[model samples]
Target: MSFTIGTREILAEPRPLPSKTVRYLVPVLSLIVGLMIGAVILLASGHDPIAAYKEVANRGFLGELPMIGTLVIATPLILTGLAAVVAFRMKIWNIGAEGQLIIGAVAASGVGLALGEHLPGWIVIVLSLLAGVAGGAFWAALAALPRAYLNTDEVISTLMLNFVALSIMNYLIFSSVSFWRDAERLTFPSGRFIADTAFLPRFWGRLHIGIFIAIGAAVLLWWILRSTKWGFEIEVTGDSGRAAAYAGIGVNRKIVSVLVVSGGLAGLAGGLEIGGVMHNLDPRALSLGVGFTGIVVAAVARLSPIGVILVAILVAGLNNSGVGLQTMGIPDDIVLLLEGIFFLCVVGGEWFLRNTIRIGVAGQPVGERSVP
Candidate 1:
C-alpha cells in the first residue's frame, strides 16, 4: 500500500514586539495615568488634588530631612520585596511573608529580653537578628513541609498561616502573661522594651543601619540571582516544572529551600523594625501591610532586587502621605485606594507589554497566537 503525502507548513507566530524602552516607559506611563485618574476622582469629590498632592510631597519626599523618613519606611519594604521576589521568581507563592515577619519579630524580642543587658551589645544584636532569621525559617517550614510532601496549595497554606501568626502574637501581648507583654503598662497591648544594646544605631536622622542592611541585601540578592547556579535552577523551575525535574533539579527541594530563604528575608525586616525603629515587638506595629505592599514592590520593580529598592522608596513615600491626605480633608485610606488603582494599572500594563490584542478578521483569532 502507498500513502499520499501532503505539504506541511509550520505557521508563523506573531511575536511580542520587543521595545527595550517600553519596558521602562510603560510602567512610568501607567503610574502617571493612575495618578491622573486619582486626581480626577479627588477633584470630583470636592477635594483639591493639587493642594493635597503638594502637602503630601511637602511632608514626604520634598520636605526637610528629605529622604530620612522615606528611607525608614523603605527599609522593611526592601527586605519584604526581596522575600516576594525570591518566591515569585521560583513560581512559589509564599504569601506568608507577613506571618514569618511577625514570628521573627516575636523571636527577636524574646532573644533581646532574655539577653537583657547580660550580654555584650554586639552579641545581643547578632543573636537577636539570627533568632529572627531562624524564626522566619521555622514559620515558613509549616507551609513548606506540607507543600513539598503533600502537594498542597501553598497559597492557601501560607495565607492561613498569616492569621495564625497574628492571632498568636495578639494573644501573647493582650491575653497572656507572655514575655512580649508589658507588665509596666497595663493600659494597652504594647510590648515590653527590648534591651538598648539590641538597637541598631541610628544615622543622622531617624534612619538606622537597617537601611544599609537592606541595601546590602538588595546587592547580595541581585548577585545571587544573576550569577549563581541555584538562581538558574529557580528560573528554570518557574519557567517549566517538568523541564526542571527532567534536568534533575529537585522541584520539592527548590520549593522548600527558596521559601525558607524568602521567609528569612522578610524576618530580617521584622527584626530590623523591632531593633531599629519600634524598639519592641508589637503585633500592631508589624501589621502595617508592609508584607503585602512588598508584593506590589516586587511586581512594580519587575522582580529585580535593585529595582525593588528604588520602587520601594517611591512607594514608601506615597504611603507616608496618609497624614497629608488627612490634613487635606481626604481620608487617609485615600492613599490605599490610589495604591490599589496604581497596582491594577501597572499589572494591566505589564500584561499589555508581554501580549498584544489584535483585531483579526472574522475567521481569525482575536487574541490567540500559536508559536512556530
Candidate 2:
C-alpha cells in the first residue's frame, strides 16, 4: 500500500486597515443615518420632520439661552464621559459612576454645609472638590476590591452598587440628620444651600468654572493615557490581560487604579453639580441618567478623551432641544428615541468597522478547491 501526502496553503485575504479619516467618517455617517431614521419616525407619527428638526436645531444650537443651557447641562456629562473613557480604556466597566457621583455630592455637601460659612471661598471650593473626588474613589474602590481579590464580576457589582448608593443618598436625605436636609422648605425634600464661598466661580454669565475643570481634566487624562507609563500599562491590560501579566504588569493593581480614577472623575461631576450649578444636595437633582448618557457619549466618541468632549456637547444639545420639541407639539419621547437611535448607529458602525464577514467555507480559498 502507498499513501500520498499533500499540503495545501490557506490564507485569508488581507483586510485593509481603516484610516483615521474612515474611523471618523463612519461615526459621522452613523449620525446622519440615525437622524434620518429619527426623521422618518417623526413623519410616520404625523409630525412634520422638517418642523420638528428645525425646532430642535434652532433651540438647541441657535437660540440664545438654549445653547448656554446645553453647555450647563453638559458639564457633568463631560466628567462622566471622562470617567467612562478612563475605565473603558482599561477594560473595566465602572457602571456605578452614577452612584459614585451621588456619593461625591453627598460628601461634598456634608463638608460645605458644615464649614462653608467659616471657610474661605478658595478653601471651601478646593475642599468640596477634593471631597467629591474622595467620595467617588471610595465608592469605586469598593467594587475594585472584589474584582481584584475575589475576581468577582465587576459589571454586576458596579451596577448593584449604583442602586445601593442611590438608596443611601435617599435615606440620608429623608431620614438622617444630615446638613442637606432643609427644615424651612417643607414643600420639597431639599438640602440647605451651601455658602456662597463654597460655590464654584462662574466663567461667564451662567457658565461655571466647572467647564474649565472638565476641559483640563480631559486634557490631563489624554496626556496621561498617551504619555505616562501607567497609561501604557492600562492600554496593555485592555489589549490583553494575559500579555500584561506576562510582562510583569500588576493586573490587580491596574484594575484598582483604573476604577479609583474612574470613580473619582465621576464623583467630581457630582460635586460640580452641587457646587457649580445646583448649590444644594437635592435628591431630585441627582441624576436623570446622566451617568448612563455618558456611557453613550463615551461610545460615540470611541472612548477617546477629546472625542468624549465633542460627543458630550452633541448629546447635551439634543437634550437641551427636547423641551423645545415638546413646545412644538412634538412628544418628549422623541428625544429618547433619537438618543437610542444615535447610540445604536454609533455602536453598530464601530462594530462593523472592526469586524467583517465571509461567506465561504472555513480554511479554504474563496474560489479554489481540489476534489477527487
Candidate 3:
C-alpha cells in the first residue's frame, strides 16, 4: 500500500520469501546495529565502549573457564527456548514457562530427596528428571484447558501462573516447615540439599551432560515437527485455526498437547538445574530469569528449534559477561538494556524483511525501493 504525508510519498509492499543469504544477513545486521547503538549510549555515559565490548568478549568466550561457564548458563536456556518455540509455532503464547520451571524444580527436588539416599545415582537422577517433567506439564495443563475449551487467553493465564508458582516454591522453603526445607538450620530458611547419589555426572569443569540432552531435544523436536503428522497439524493450526479445523485437525487437542509438551521441556530444564548444578531448590539461585530469556532466544532464532540452541548460547554469553562487566564499572542493568535493545532491533528487522519501503516527493513516482 502507498500513502502520502506532506511532501513525501511512502510505499510499503509485501516482500517475497527471502533468499537464504538474506535470511541470515538480517539478524547479523540487526545485532551489529544493536551493538552500535549500545556503544553510542556507553560513550554518552562516559564509558569506553570498546573496552566494555572487549571485556564482554574476554569473559564470555575467550577464556576456557568463561566459555564453559557460558555453556553452563546456556543449558537451561536451550530447554526453555525450545519450550517457547513449540508453543509459539502454533500461535499459542505460553508465557508461563517461568512458573513451569519453578514447579518443575520443586517436583524434581522432591523426587531427588525422596530417592537420593535409597536408590542408585542413575535411577535417582532419572526419576527426578521425570518428576520435573511431569510437574511442568501438569502446571501448564491448568492454563491449557481453559485456553482450549473456554477460549481463555493463554498469555495472561500463563503469565499470572508464574507468580503463583514462585509463591508456591517460596512457601515450601521459606514460609513453612515443609519437607523441602532444611530443618537443621533454624536461624535462616534454606532448602535441603539432595543426596550425592542424585547428582548428575559431570563431564568437564562444572559442565554436565545436560548440554547434550538439550541439543538432543532440539534435534528430536525438529524431527517431530518436520516429519510427523502431529507436527503437520500443529503447523496448520498455527497458520490458521479455521483452516486446520476444516482439514480435520483437532485444534483443541493440539492446543493442549503442544502447550503441555512445551511446559515439559521447560520443566526438564529445572530438573537438570537441580540435578546438574543446584542439588537443592534454592529460590534465590533458581530465579535467574532464564525462562524469560528463552522467549527472547526463541524470537531471535525465528522460532526454529535448532536455531534456539545457537541463539541461547549467544544470549547466555552476554549473561556470563554480566559479572565481569561490573568490575569494569558497568552496571548490570546495562547488560539487560543491551539485550532489550538487541531484541527490539531483531523484531524491527523481521518487520522490514517482510515489507519493502519506498519514498519519493508527494507528486512523484516511488523512485527507489529498499529491502531489509
Candidate 4:
C-alpha cells in the first residue's frame, strides 16, 4: 500500500475573510463573557450579583475618598505595568520586576535613613528617588548583560534575582537593626521613616503626587513608543528579530537598554510605594505582588501604554472593590477568580484574532476542493 500527502495539509491559518471588527469586538465580548461566567458562579453559590456589585461600587467607588484611594493604589500598578510593556515590546521577558522593586525600596530606605533629616530635605528626597531608580536598573541590567552577551535564559535569571533581592531586604531589615530597623517598633523589624520632603504630598486626604507621576510616566512612555526613532526600533524588534538585524538594528544593545529601563520603572514604583505612601520599608508591606499584577495588566492591555493606565485602574478598582465585598459576606478571592477567567478569555480571544481552524480529515489537503 502507498500513502499520498498533499502540499496543503490540515492546518490552521489566517482566516480567508477575517473580520476587522472582530479584532476589537472579540476582546470586549470576551470580557463580558468572563464577567457573565463570574456572575453565574456567584449565583450558583447562592449570592446575588446585583447586590454584590452594588456594595462593591458603593464601598469601592462611591465611598469617601474612594476615587483618590483607587488612584493611589493604581500608581504602582501603572508604573509596573509600563515596565512590563517596555521589556515585553522588545521580546524580553524580564520577570524580576518584584525583585527590582524590592531592591529599589532597599536603596530608597538607605538613602532615607542616611539623609532624610540631616541634609536638605528636598535634596535628600531627590537623591533618594534617583537612587531607587538606579538600584532597580542596576539589578535588571545585571540579568540583561547575561542575556544579551551570553544568551542566558532571562526567565530563570530574572526570577532567581527576585529571591536574591528579597533575601537581601529581609537580611538588612531583620539582621541589622542599626540602619534599617526603626527603634520605636521594637515589636517588629522595620525601616526608618522617609523625610517630610520625600513624602509625596497628598491631596484630598489619600491621594498623593504619585498619581501625577504615574500618569505623567504613562503619557511619556506612550509618546516614546508611538512617535520616536527608538520607538520604531522597538516595534521592529518585536515584530521580527531577523528583520531587525537585516535593517542594521542592534538587537543585543536594544535588549539590554530596554531591560534597564524596565527595571528602572519597576524600581520607581518601589520608591513611590515607599516614599509617597508607606514612608517606611518592610517586606510585609510590599507583599501584595504589585509586579505580578502589573504583568497581568500589561497582558490584558496588549502592551499599550495608554491602555496600561486604564487597565491598571480597573485592576486596582477590582482589588479595592473585592476587599469591600468582603463586608457583604463575599470573599475577596472571588475577584481573583474573575481575573483568572478574564486572562483565559483574553488568551482565547487573541488566538481567534490570528487564526481559524478548519475541520478536515487527517492528511487531507487544506483549502482544496474535495470530491463528493
Candidate 5:
C-alpha cells in the first residue's frame, strides 16, 4: 500500500546504505534547521536569537577561561557520550549510563576513602579509577544479564536501574550514615572528601587530566570499533542479529560485553569527576543530567567515537551558555529549547536519511524492498 503526495504515489523504502554525503549532510542540515527554528522561537519571545547565539559563543569558547569551563563540563560528557556510543553501536538501548556513573562515583569514593590512609596518592588515584570502572560494569551487568539471558527489554531495565542507582547515591549521602558520608558534618548531608592524592591532576583552571583520559578513551574506542574483529562483529550484529548468528557470531555475548564496556566508560566519567573536579561524592553536584545529555551527544554525532568528543564539547558549550542567555534577558530555558530542537531535528534527519522516497503512478505495483 502507498499514500499519495499530491498526485503521485509516495513510498519510503529502506536503502541498503545511506549515501556518505547524506550521512554528513544530515547533521549539518539538522543544525541549520534547529537554528532557524530556534530563531523563530526567540523572535516570538521578543529576544534576538543572533545576539543570544553570539553570547553563547563568547561564553563557551571565545575566551580562555570560558574555554576551560566548557572543557571542564565536557570531561564527563565525553565519557558518557562514548558509553552511549558503545552500547548504541550494537543496537543495545542501555539507558543506565546515568546510574552507572553514580555507582562508579560511589565505588571510587568508597575505595579512595577506605584506602587513602594506607596508600600513596598515585596508588589511591589508580585504585579509585579502577573501582569506578568496576562499579559501573557491575551495575550495567544487573541489566545486561537479564537482557542477554532472559531476552528482557533492556530499555526498561536500564532506565529503571538509573533510578535505583540514584536512590543508592542518595541513601549513602542523604538518608543513611553511610561510609561515603562525612561523619563530622552534623548538620548538612555531605559526602566525605576523597584523599588529596586521589584528586586528578589539573593542567589549567579546573581542567584536569580527566580530559586527556576522555580523549584517550575516545581514541582507543575509535580504534577498536574501526580496526578490530570484535568491532566488525558488533557492526554485523547491529545490522542484523540473525545474519550475525548465521555467521557464527555470539550475539548474546556481544550484548553483555558491549553493555559492560559502555557502563565502564560511564563509570570512568564518575571516577574522573570525583578525582578531577568534585573531589567528593556530592549528589547535588553529580546529578546534573550529564548522563542523559550523553545520549543526545551520541545521537548527534551519529555514534562516531571521535564525533562524540566534538559533540560533547558543543553540547557542553550550549549548556554553559545558559548564563549568557540569562544576561541577554533570555530565559535559560531557551537553551534547553534549542537543545531539544536540535535533538529532534537530528533524530528526524536520521530517519529521513535511512529511507528513500519514491514517486510512482497511483495503483502501480512497487517491487519489494528490504527493511533496514
Candidate 6:
C-alpha cells in the first residue's frame, strides 16, 4: 500500500496602501463632519448654531490676546502630543503622561530651589530642564519594565500611575515638607516659586519660551523618526514584534527606549509649565487635563510629529473658546461635548481606514457558507 503526498503553498493577499493624499484628507474630512454634527446638536437644542460658532471662532482665533492665550495653553498640549505620537507610533501605550508631567515639574522645582539665588541663570535653566527629563523618564521606566519583561498591559499600568503621580503632587503641595511646599502661605496650596534665574525667558511679552521649545521638539522628533536608525527599528517593532526580532531588533530595548523618550518629552512640558509660565508647582494649575487632551490631539494628527502641532493648536483654540461659550449664553459643557465628538470622529476615521464593513444578507454569519 503506497500513499501519495502533495504539497501546496498559501500566500496572503497584499493590502493596498492608502495614498498620501487620502491619509491627509481623511482627518480633515473627519473634522468637518464632527463640526457639522456639533452644529446640528446645537441647533436642535434651541441654540443659534451660526451665532454660537461665530462666537467660538471670534473668541478663539480673531483676537490677539485670546490667540496668544490659546498658544500659551497649546504649548503643553503640543509637548504631550509629541509624547503620545512618539510612543504610539512605536505601538507603546503611555497613558501616564499626566503623572509623568507632574513628577517632572516637581523635580524641576526641586532643582530650582536647590540652586537658589547663587546659581547662574543659564545653569539653572539647563539643570531644571534636565531634571524634568530625568524625572519623567524614571516614572515611565516603571511601566516600561513590566511591559517589556512580563507583557503587562501598559494601558492599565500607565493610567493607574497617573493617580499615583497626582497624589504625590498633592502631597508635596499640602502634606509633605518637600521642597515644593510653600511655607509663607498656609491658606492656599502652592509650591515655592522657581527663582527668576531658573524661569524660562518670555518671548514677545505674551508668548513664553516654551512655545519655541515645543516647536523645536516637534522638528527634532520629525527628523529622528524619518532620518535615524533607531526610528526605523521603532517603526519595524511597532509593525510586528516577531518580524522585528527576526530582523535583529531588540524588542524590549526598543520598548524601553521609546517609553523613556516619550516620558522625557512629557516631563519637559511640565518643567516648562512651572519654569516658563506658572513659575510655581501648584497642583490645581497643573491639572489642566492637557495630558489627556493630548491623546486626542495625537489621534487627530494620526500620530505624526508635524501634524501634532496643528492638532494641538486646534484643540487649544477649542479649549479657549469653551470658556467664551458660557458668556454667549451657551453651556460650557457643550465645548466638552464638541471635543468628545471630535475625538470620536478622528478615532472612527482611523478605524474606517483600516477596515471594511459588510452587511449580512440574512442575519446569519455573513461570511460563513452553509453545509448542504
The best candidate in terms of TM-score: 3
Instruction: Please report the TM-score between candidate 1 and the true structure.
Output: 0.91
Candidate 6 local lDDT, 346-370, one digit each (tens): 7787654654344443324445332
Q: Point out where model 3 deviates above 4 Å.
A: 1-10, 367-372
Encode model 3's per-residue lDDT on 1-372: one tens digit a residue. 889989988878877787888888888899899999999999999899999999889998887898899999999999999999999999999988999999999999999999899989999999999999999999999999999999999999999999999999989989999999999886888999999978989887899989999999999999999999999888999999999999999899999999999999999999999999999999999987888889989989999999998989888888899999999899977889998998899878887678767777888767544453
Model 5, TM vs. native: 0.91
Question: Ten consecutive residues with minimal summed lDDT in candidate 6?
Answer: 1-10
lDDT of 1 by residue, 1-372 (tens): 112224322233344674988788888899888889889989999999888878678767986475788889999999999999999998898888889899999998889888968998778988898888888888888999899889999999988998899999899998888878888888776899988877888987798999999999999999998899998898999999999999999999999999999999988988888889998878777788888888888988989999999989888888887887787679988888888888888877786576544444444334555452
* Model 5 lDDT per residue over 88-147, tens place: 999999888999999999999999999988888899999999999999999999999999
lDDT of 4 by residue, 233-282 (tens): 99999899899999999999999989999999999888888888888888
Can you give the lDDT of residue 287 in candidate 6?
Answer: 81
**Residue ranges of candidate 1 with Cα displaced over 4 Å:** 1-17, 63-66, 357-372
- In terms of lDDT, the poorest run of 10 residues in model 4 is 1-10
- In order of appearance, the predictions have TM-scores of 0.91, 0.90, 0.95, 0.88, 0.91, 0.88
Among these predicted structures, which one has the highest lDDT?
A: 3
Tell me the spans in candidate 6 whose CA falls farther than 4 Å from its real position. Answer: 1-15, 355-372
lDDT of each: 0.85, 0.85, 0.92, 0.83, 0.90, 0.84
